[model samples]
Target: MTSGAPSDWYRWIPEQISARDYELLPEDFCRTIEVVDGHIVKCESPSRLHNRVARRIATHMEAGRKPEPCLMVDTDVDVRISDVPLSLRRPDVIVYRCLDDDAKLYAGDTVLVVEVVSPDSSFHTDTVEKKAAYAAAGIPVYLIVFLTEAADGIELIEEYRLSEGRYHLVCLHTRRLTVDSPIPVDIAFGDLASG
Candidate 1:
């Protein structure tokens, strides 16, 4: 009937909403939501500073890499994992291999997903649950850049790499540091912490 399925059309009305029913979102909606296991989770909105940092990261990655073969979508891009039928999640940024003549709705084989952690997102969901979920989906790198200005001042940069079905903390940089990775890049801690 609308962007969502017939069931999700009425917000206040009581009806069973499944994953399949959750994908029917209005095309013009400004915000993007992730339907995980029938629960609607709002994605973290990018602050101006967050957007700046994200843009820098994507730009650097794109410029430095030769034959750049990945698609970088902003926070509004959705990546659906087949694990749950109705689960449609929009990462702050996602990088996936450029498919040849593949015009699929969702890019599930995303190699990297970056989340600029925000106050609106559930800590456990982003730092823990989503970590595991990405690993299960074969997402190689899950980068988290913290914006909270503490003693480190955006120094808490986490690089979790998936290996053998588990995500192990590979590097935790508390200062402006370079990460030697399959992605290959340096992150300015100040850029992330700055207003």
Candidate 2:
């Protein structure tokens, strides 16, 4: 195996960056990186199918969302988990409260977070690491979308709810996703697939 230090712009990156300082980074540069414990972690570009599923889910959630809570659905946005050590994650889809100003979103503002499992994604990171982090951040709901064996579309969705400072498996939806907490949402897996 060939091994060498990262070259070019990567070499110039500092060992760690605070959440506040991370915001000062170039928008384009910040788009492809996530901060974990103040360290920069490069994010891989997800497949088109992954993006499509996330977008469809977001669309469905927005359409069925209730008006009372005043929530917003967005895709690929950073949710700051902590600032002291600077832990942040860019979830595939996020449901957050409507903010007055266009500022950074904190975990407290988040209602639900979704992560679509791509062929190249690490199962442990999606199911364990991110789940634990989101729970610790006090996000109420977490969804993990599993792709079909053929990688053509969504196959299953595991919904978890935070209880007593930890997430518990609340529901599993294979054909149709329906959830009541955080907001009522109903989305068919078939609709999330590309034609």
Residue by residue across 8-125, what tens digits does model 1's lDDT show? 5546322434544553545434154666655666555567766766666666565455465555444446677653445556666677766543454354567778776664555667
lDDT of 2 by residue, 1-195 (tens): 113323354555678877656765667778898899999888889887888888988888888788878998999988999998999999999999998657879999999999998756657789988999999999999999998754347778999999999999989998888988777777678778765
Off by over 4 Å in 2: 1-12, 150-152
Error of 1 at 96 (Å): 0.7
Q: What is the TM-score of each candidate against the true structure?
A: 0.77, 0.90
Error of 1 at 118 (Å): 1.8
Q: RMSD to the native, candidate 1?
A: 3.7
Lowest lDDT sum, 10 consecutive residues, model 2, at 1-10
Error of 2 at 24 (Å): 2.9
Candidates in order have lDDT scores of 0.63, 0.84
